[model samples]
Target chain A: MPKSVMHATRAGQPLQPVGRRRFLQVASVATASTALLISGCNKDDDTPSAATVDLGSGDVGVLNYAYALEQLEAAFYAQIIATPYTGISAEEQAYFTSIAKHEAIHRDFFKAAITAAAPGNIIGSLTPDFSSVTFTDRSSVLSTAKTFEDLGVAAYNGAGKLLKNTDYLLLAGKIVSVEARHAAVIRDLINNGDFAADDVVDASTGLDKAMSVDEVLMAAQAFIKEKITATNVGK
Target chain B: MNLFHLISQVEKLDPQAMDQLVSRRNIFTQLAGMSKKAALVAAPLLIGSAFNQVLAGNKDVPAVFNYALLLEYLEEDFYLQALAKPGLIPTGAPMNAIMQIKKHESAHVALLKGALGGAANPRPSSFNFGAAFDNYPTFLAFAQALEDTGVRAYKGKAGEIKEAGNPNDYLTVALQIHSVEARHAAHIRMMRRGAAGGGIMQAGWISNAEANGAPQVVYGPGNPATTFPSEGNTTQAGLNLVTALGTTYTAAEVSEAFDEALDEATVRSIAGPFIVA
Candidate 1:
């Protein structure tokens, strides 16, 4: 196996020789080019930096894009459960905890699957700041949960079609369904019995609204301190 | 070898050689039993090998379908379990509503199976509902898990239909099923909370303000935006009113929540096996 393939396997992603070869060459050139360009360019700007991982072109990019989002979520929930909120009610605590466990399992599972199939292109860790979150208050925690859950459903809805691989597409479907459940529970927690009202879903299209990668990443940037970019995504 | 060379070798080869080459190449001229193109692509790899094992023995189907079937079974069983329990449906109105939901889930199971078509595998005789319903805590946990799965499943498949380039008919129906599933999820969440009312908020936003008044909003009492903001009202109706009153949360807040939930790793883990198939 090539060094790139070995790196991918180590990262727990599937090894796609063709994709791997292309990714290595492209990534090396892109990184070198980006570094050189950055040295010459102005650093101050309000615009969010593009994702570092080039997701490649077409559906593969979409899958990798989706993968990056899942990584962020898994990390967030892992942290949430690792340190339970200060004054969590029993029911509320358990609910969030189970979600955390589920998210972690999902994260690991994707890591393994991607390592096995695509090989060597897993995006790096995302640093999240919970400084704004008052984990002690039930309202604060649940509200945060609601925000994450709702955004997840929309992100999946938006990117579902961009995937080229039928297998990856199927996997996305399964995960999105779970995200919807999280959204419902969190919504209800904020307001009693308000799980699927017109607030989260559209009455006219009857479809969950979608967010582009740019939109989703911008929103997430607040929580993450590191400058992140998507490479080979939808390339 | 180049693709053309491979194709030329197969064309010039004998019947047995052709068979070996085709199998080796993993290319199918026509999927034996599937009618739809997408199904043809998926069937040869998924149902062809795994279907027999699932049928011959009691093992679970491969990943995506396995999870999908499991969710369908859970939803089906949840309704049965809820209906079987007493005090879940109090009096005429609630009972009627519960019955409607039950019927819808039954239809959902049917449709889910329909998507599987002739390849529809047999249902497992029983499932471990886990510790979800042994008590309120367990029940809430299970309900959350199932609802979350359902929402993602629909969202995930919607794009598949579009990519197949078939009329959006199947996608439309799936979305419809998803909306109902969303309703089911909302209802279950209410039940988990032991709330008495119905028509809780759905998962997506409704942009139309004229037909439906401003969307309901919820706020933590700290903001000096409106009256009784400090009450921490947990009622569905109250939250809806508050959201409509003014936007307490930014688009970033809403979208970040979504990103956290729809993380690519999580979705891939759940659907990886099926997609690879």
Candidate 2:
């Protein structure tokens, strides 16, 4: 059994949204070949870099997987609201605010739960690279939002069965359905009536998408500033 | 989704059930070995694959499976009837989507039936789907209620399935169904939002509180809807969303954050009118 560990960012300023809420720290780094120094479990390298982050294993790993995604979601929505997209109505602003706040709470809730469950195992604040996402445009913002929201719904669906504890499964269930709601809303915003379009929900199966850890992490790597390994989750 | 019932049943009789693929012939052979009381006790254990897995679990696992089967029957029948009615559904995207939904429900019915073998509960004798909305306006509102109720109904029973534990391969499949149900619910909301009188557009997600004019949104005659109230409930696991989530969150966000769960009793009532005697 490997000891639960988060190698790089210990007391490293966790990612925080700019303005309004205080106490969050933003990091800088992007587009490098990955390094997962999850090894050297006992070794202490005084200097920390953005190269590698191992979410740990068992339930801790599952929690970290969720936390990483939440961090990404929180950052994504934060960027959207910070600079409102053009043609953004007052109604749109309020809706986006609601989305941002929910993601933040989701990010923080996992952080709090993991800290209580395993003090040092929680992953640090994730960096966001929204370079390609034009925050000034509603189409760009909504498209990005649609991707993140659908990815979240699929991630939870994939991860649920791996959970051993019923409490954790139930919690994941509670959150995932909400994610499904978010995905549906975003999809509708993009195209009037394609909320559960055949792309995400299979035509034959009548089932929504569920991605394996590798599949989810692969799709997620685009916006995320750091490399992640979800393959070992719950192993 | 209720794997516990199936797994424990398997633990007691695996190789026998395994050799058969929930084979009816083998299952019946074993059924003959037991006395009347024993057979009664073992009935739930006899499920070849997915069973009722309904909320308000019955120790008799078959009962749970039957409940789920009944739900599929209702959804499948309702959609099929709507698509069949003239001018009831708009001809384009709405019709196309409802057709897809009906197709899925039919698939669900087939899957559940195959899983149950000979034990599958037949669809209730006759079902009343309320006034067939000849127009998209009435239809979308009706669709929203049915889809919303379906999502809640599945969720309400999920815990029991979770508790049933492993080889509960049924749980995974059931969850697949549950998530899709949610998407179905969302799609309906999306269409309603675009409707002329649809005030729900600004509110695509199910809120912590039901919308002010939500009562009129429900479908199915005679089913006093208790499921919608909980849709807006803000407190979860004893934590009040408004107080605990900080001031930045407006009441709406808090409302949107968590979807409410329906218990079996409430779901049954919601489905009662639709399931004719």
Candidate 3:
């Protein structure tokens, strides 16, 4: 559940695939010097220098960022359910189990989408650290869930503009709605109807929170062990 | 509203006369967009023409805005009606939270109206705004469906909305409102659980297609067919979820992983019943 994937380059392609002359150039290089390039294109060669996780720029980076957040959520929910938070009801247990399943589904969806879209360029799964979370306490679990869910929504919101491809944008839109749904549920679980509470939505504007990749990563980095960076995102 | 619907409304006008009401160029531009990019190669110029047509006493670009404005009016009015009725909202957190929701919807209505100015479609004379009973369970049940529908509806037509000049501004506003609708869906679903005497809580997202044995139900039998078909769909960009990710996730989990967009037609149909005479 703590798994994080790191990919090279950015998120999915936004514009139509670089067509015509660019495509021919890439095609020629591929077929012209097959063996030497093939031999050089091994897994070891693909890792970014210094091994720091770089979510590639543009749409792919956004997808990677989303994949990382979903992984964190899946892991957190799994832990709470596995240990069973103190005094957790059978009902609450069932509810969180559903949440855990949903996060896992989301995590796997991104993994599958990224891999299908970028193949070798896809990020590798990441490992997470949860030392600070008090798994035995209901308060801690729900609060953490709230944080993850809200962060997920904000990340998706902020990343929407970065996509040049409407398809990727639409796909991200699909997931962000679910994340918002999760955020509201977790908030209500902690305190009913605090779903779009003042903290998350600006009282004056009434718009829901949206955080840039850098802002979301600041809160996300502590729970994740990877040396993640997002400067190239949307670039 | 969509182009075909708008076109059908203007069928009686002669070409030259209609040009005075709504530009022929702008209508074709909107039609090009609605036809899913048949003429998209001319996008920048098409959009420029569209933008100019809107500003030049035509309701072309504003037609799409009016669609959004109309929906916001529907939602704001629905919430206000619910709040007016006693016993629909339970006391304390749920009620207060819903009140905030109503306010946000109202703000959305106002925001769109301000953006549209004179071009905004007037609100329908009245809305149905119900799944019948005035009890909390009934109110929340309808609220969940409405909000969920709103999310899909926005996503479905976002491409259409993006055509009204600035792609950046239209998309940003649509997404902002989309997430809020999702939040509302979740909270209402959560409250409905309490009203129904909770067992295991439903996942905040729709878990599966109603056709494929989704564990939880979303819309009732009466909702238009497109509503559930879209929600239950698990395909994206020609990739089927279960086929692509089946090894790791169960079929249900695979379905839960992605939300689907309804076509503009489906969106109009979904909102059809709620538009009371």
Candidate 4:
């Protein structure tokens, strides 16, 4: 399980709610601070809240979800570029630079588009926690890159069905492929022939993995500081 | 509520629920036999394959799916033929990557045929690979083009598939397959650039329609310029990405950021020369 559950309940309550108080607390806090905890709270403990954001409903929610992912990816690549891991080849450095640019563009594109479409609904700039990653080690860096890239692909694949707008679906389609390409390259960097391994691509179906929104957020929760609620996303 | 959620619930109960139904070969009769709640719980799982069988119910989806199958067949055939040649691919890393890609293409072919069932298009008997088999670099170039085209083709069809079904989940399936093609394309590009001569130096992602030595037709605008723009397109959703953000990004970087789709007509025209059905 991810350190935190991205699905929301009421602030100061446990991950699951018990009664009308939970619903009432959630409603009262919806337009307030919206801060929930990122650290794993006990199943039944009444926890204090901090650093949380809610991905709103419908198309705006979907865009915010995408934006949240882009922010995570862009931050990752930017960090990779900022401190090149030991023994990183010149070629790998150059490739990382290009990838950083692509991710940054994706992040900024979502920001601009969302601001124009629904300024208030756009998600805030997320704070990434890359403490788990060892920037000094090439193996650690590339492996983390592989994880993020694969996660991005699966998230987009799963999210496609949730999109009500075809244009947004197409846009997601465009970016997911690029993320897949990144995933492939990163995998190859780790293991020359493991670009599309059986783990990532189903041996029986030949399709890449499609993770649900909750699943994606759970997987990504460890890398982020802020808690996120995607319950209303695509509803 | 989406029926897919129910399907997920049923899958949790029995992971092979759809497969068992598929083996029975009378999904509709079976669904009809079940109680309405059970059928409601099972319909989305059935829709994955039966939706194609229900071709008469929706022409648009089958047409788009068939086109996808055709492209998969083309790619599978292309990889199969190239892999068949003795020593066409290098022995170490190159061979390993090609073999992996070949397996994936074959898997994609199997998945598409399985999904489409009787409606699936038959594979072409012959292929005209010209100089692709003559040298390793040439093979890589052709492989890159086909993989890149596959990515774009699937992207182009997303709208078609999304519009056709009542949450058929084919759109998600197509998206799943779409990313795998991109992975293949990037690996092929890696192999090309790693070649000793540096003759086919290329980025893993498309950069300003740079075909390197691959077919130019794969990168240019398709039938209608508006719908299927060139791979070098810098503008997305009406804003030039390079200038959209306050930060400065080169046009090449902006273009490399997002891939563009090609219409089905243009994709068929590009792949038509090699397929001899």
Candidate 5:
């Protein structure tokens, strides 16, 4: 593998170069006249187009879609740890810190896997604005955590069908379950022992609410200023 | 102009465009002034109706199939590894339960393959079970981890088919598989507590209190101190396990044991390595 790829895998960073040889191949393809011309065309056509990160349609799109969400979560938690919340109990801080580490690991894991499996197709980083959030307040932080976690569960649920890859689906299953746990914990923090209530999960179906890519994008758009689009997502 | 003249002029233009133009003009608004009824009537027509659009375009068979196949590989590999070890499962009832669980996981692999249908990738020659179950402590830990993860995976993906507005056929099959996985988790927790005199384990779970209370005492069957369901009907099926075992254990007690076995940190820790690196 290339040094960059090795470094990325080690550091758990997204957009790792695949390998020296593969990098050359990709570089060659990029520098080739036809490819360059196509790239140029895309750059020039600035007709108020929605900024979208092409996930390459179908199952690939779903994976990239998930990858994008993981990135957001990872970034959020990373920020949380970088600046520890004031007045947080030691136990609570430890718990949240561990969770932040887990999320970061998850984000990087997806990035590495996607890079290895499908190079040149990773979703770009979203510029998140937490202006409305007051991280100092425990309740405010927990409430925000609850919303993100719940949104994650619903988003995963909604995106599952669009996923064509069972491996990705399985991976998603693993991640979402963790997200559910996070949701439950945050819920408990807000209200004693109200973790798995009827509000979050439907009693009859035993399933969380499902939100489509469009729905999630709209919800996430509030925090994210950049226009993130999933190109080549669910075909 | 008179109402008749206005109506005639409106009829001359394209109906759709003309209606929009008139609606925009609010001639009715000018005529009726602050009339709310006109607004209400026009709102429905002016605002387009919402309908579920089925954007069933291209289904990516390779990506979808590969993803499902990977999970099957994980489950299949876990059981294969567990079954390979000799003294992991006790003989008679405990062994039987493990065998059944192994069979169910195998069935899951097969069922998932079937779902993948033709597009399924060829199975990998081998799988790296990683450092999850390096020792007995790790083995139990991994087992708990897998079961918890399996439960979550099912919960997470069950709504996918629903979101696509697809038929419930796929979701039903997936849920059935999910329930089986949960049962396996519950049974494993029972065996871990050395229930049933270390052999011929019953279906009921051993509460943490019971497990920690006495050294040799199995909570169910012969013990009178432990509570079980009476010989009557109840709404919940889980309680029936207690009844079947002839033990007096509350549903909450049984549930707590399951909860204790599947902790969130443990689940995250087990899955974390797999997800990131």
Candidate 6:
């Protein structure tokens, strides 16, 4: 088995959400090009970029995957609280503070759990690239928060089947609902009645979006400096 | 919504329906051959799926899917009946949120019914909401409970379906619906904030048994306390999250950080009033 590793950071790529989504659409269509990256395991040597960090296989991979997302969320909320958006109301401020604390606690919980379970296998701290988010503005911050929360919920939901341990599965179940709550509140914050919007939750199925590791990583990779490889995640 | 009620109605229609389901208990036999851990984890899903197949006459549908369908039926009907009222929910965000939620519930009912195939025929639904629609605040309270319960019900079943060790992606689909329920719960909570006195207004996420513990059963434990803890539980996997995470978090924050699941029986009881024969 390959050791869990975090490679050197490669910076300087600012996030363009629209561009990334467009690229993902095109990449998804050109299946051959992205199949190797998304479908299965690609050894470190087989990959082009040595700067990638492997999330490792099975339960550890699942944990690291969650840790990475929590790190992203905690970082986003921390920034939101550090520099409150202009004209932030007292209620909104309270909302952000509570949300920030919850995200931070989640990140730390994942960190502690992984450290105890896998020792040195836990992934290192992630550096989130929030250049795309205009933290000074309420709409910008709330919109970004909504994206992160919804993504987190989908990521956890998608990862459920990957877990081999029932305990880990239950833990993930516990957290995902909270993430959903966060997603809903953030959606409402952005625009009332948008909590379970058709965009994230299917109108036909009435189910929230569920994204695979590859799909989640594709969207999340744009926000983090470190390249994450989950090819063997939950394998 | 209420499994007992639904089963009784089925029994009235066909005296040997339960016998047919029991005789074809493939999922139970599978459970018998598994280790304790696997059996414990998978029984809920396998049994549920088994029922789905037998009851729905759809081999592809899982019991958990039907369980979800039933809940969606209650919620869809709840909102549909409420919205149909003359001057019930006031205009603006409150009405708009209720409308959006109603739409999603109706969609969910359609999705589950589609999955159930021919067995998706409507069961008897004589709702007894009584004066809930006459007042907005009362309607919001019931909505919050139902939504919150819906979230927990889905969570309780998620692990079971995933651990069933099947190639089916039912777990993911269940989770997709689960979070949407949470979103609906939070939306309703926000709408009802400050509607209650004593500063016990509801938050987007649950904070303990909630104000006054009026509907304690909704926020309380299930058949087994160990498997399904209360909403205010600060402990996860036998570890006190508050103490483990240091003093930065209070019991409420710790509780809010994670939502607990409720077993099927508990959920049925909680939702019994709204569902009648």
Q: Model 5: residues >4 Å from true position, as ranges? A: A1-52, B1-277
Per-residue C-alpha lDDT of model 6 across residues A103-199, encoded as one tens digit per residue: 8878988988998899878999877867567788877788778778988998998898889888898889889989988888888777777888888
Instruction: Return the TM-score for candidate 5, rounded to 2 decimals.
Output: 0.43
Question: Could you tell me the TM-score of chain B in model 6?
Answer: 0.74
Per-residue alpha-carbon lDDT of model 1 for B1-277, expressed as tens digits? 2555544643442222343344434434445445687765786575345323222212222223344555566567776786777764455634554565566566556755654444455765654444444544345445544554455455454543554331223444554456456655545544534533433232232111111111122111222223112112211112332233244333322221221113223433433332212
Query: How many residue-pair clashes does candidate 3 contain?
Result: 17
Q: Report residue B133 deviation for candidate 4 (angstroms).
A: 1.1
lDDT of 2 by residue, B43-150 (tens): 767743334322112243345556777888988888887877887777787787788778778877887676566667777888887764556666666666767777
**Evaluated on chain B only, what is the TM-score of candidate 2?**
0.72
Model 6 lDDT tens row, B30-104: 889999999999977876766554445323235667777778888988898999997888887777888888888
Task: Sort the predicted structures by TM-score, highest score first.
Answer: 4, 6, 2, 3, 1, 5
Please write out the lDDT profile of model 2 over residues A1-235, one tens digit for every residue: 0000011123233232222111111112111211232222214533343456888888789889999999999988888788899889886787677778778877867876787789988888888767556788888788888888888988887787777777677667767777887787777777856777788887776777777787787667656667676656887
In terms of DockQ, the best-performing candidate is: 6
Give the candidate number with the greatest lDDT: 4
Task: Give interface RMSD, every candidate, in order.
Answer: 10.9, 2.0, 1.9, 1.0, 14.0, 1.2
Candidate 2 deviant stretches above 4 angstroms: A1-49, A89-94, B1-65, B132-136, B197-202, B211-229
What Cα-based lDDT does every candidate model obtain?
A: 0.49, 0.66, 0.67, 0.79, 0.50, 0.76
Candidate 1 residue lDDT tens string, A116-161: 5667665555556454455556666666677677677677666654
Off by over 4 Å in 1: A1-53, A230-232, B1-163, B166-183, B189-277
| Tens-place lDDT digits, model 3, residues A96-193 | 87778778877877888888787765677776757556788777777778878888888888777777667787788778888888788778878877
Better of 1 and 3 by TM-score: 3
lDDT, residue A169, candidate 5: 61
After superposing candidate 4, which stretches have Cα over 4 Å from the reference? A1-48, B1-57
DockQ each:
0.05, 0.37, 0.40, 0.60, 0.02, 0.64
Better of 1 and 3 by lDDT: 3
Residue A185 deviation, candidate 5, in Å? 1.2
- Give TM-scores for every candidate, taking all chains together and pairing residue i with residue i: 0.47, 0.74, 0.73, 0.81, 0.43, 0.78
Give the clashing pairs for model 4: none
Candidate 5, residue B260: Cα displacement in angstroms equals 18
